[model samples]
Target: MRLRVCGICIQNERILLINHSLYGKDTFFWSPPGGGVQFGETATEALEREFLEETGLRVKVGKLLFINEHIEAPLHAVEMFFQIDSFEGTLKTGEDPELSAEGQVIEQVQFLSWDELTQFAPNQLHRIFSMIGSLDGVFHLQNYIPGQNSGLEK
Candidate 1:
């Protein structure tokens, strides 16, 4: 199983998201900016690196917010999402070093408001995205198990 780290950054009521289409043009998934942790790197360090690589932003990683288990056949990932304490630099689309220019699937990176997110089909977004507006200070650590229906499946 791959261990992944994701950073959550909310500003002006908009949340940062990376648009990815992993399964041809029909399947799109929107999630926070983050990636697999490299060897000998702490989760926080990996998150910082990923944010820089995917969003072109230098961010300070904060407390852990949620732990997610994603198991869908050959792809099993344990993902940790943390709140970004602070950030610097202007927002721009960043590239993943692991993929070639033509192989990259990241289409866009931008801050999306809660209302905008609701327009997407439920299955297209991260499970936690629905609760984004209600999230206040200090969210308790939560767990999302695989196979649980989000009721947004298309």
Candidate 2:
């Protein structure tokens, strides 16, 4: 099972996202710049690496925001979302090659205004953004029953 942690690097009313070009998809789905936790790295470390690689910024991860369990995602896809409060550096695309993930190279790496964020796929993220105030109540644990199936028969 693989464990990954990502952070929503929000600044100046805009959020950081990557435009992925994998699986033959032409359009982009918005996601925070984050990736899998390595064998020995902590969640904060992984986030710092991913952010630097993808967005070219040094981030200060603040608090754990959400933990998502996706039955439909690939194997062992547990994601932790965090609140990043502070950072240093100019935001750009693919400034750190070492931090790039598979199929994730910075193309349009700038802060997207709130209105701009709506022009992406998976509309639920919009609600996710609105619900940021209730961050503590947003995390849902799915299909954790020991014997029973998760019932995520999608």
Candidate achieving the largest TM-score? 1
Give the alpha carbon lDDT tens digit for every residue of 7-87 in model 1.
889888778999987666667889999999999999999999999988889999998887877766556688888999899
The total number of steric clashes, by the backbone 3 Å criterion, in model 1 comes to 0
All candidates: TM-score: 0.86, 0.70
Clashes of each: 0, 0
Question: lDDT at 49 for candidate 2?
Answer: 91
Question: How well does candidate 2 match the true structure, expressed as C-alpha RMSD?
Answer: 5.3
> How well is each residue in 122-145 modelled by candidate 2, as lDDT tens digits?
542423444343323234322231
Q: Lowest lDDT 10-mer window, candidate 2? A: 140-149
Backbone clash total, candidate 2: 0
Residue 15 in candidate 2 has what lDDT? 71
Prediction 1 global C-alpha lDDT: 0.82
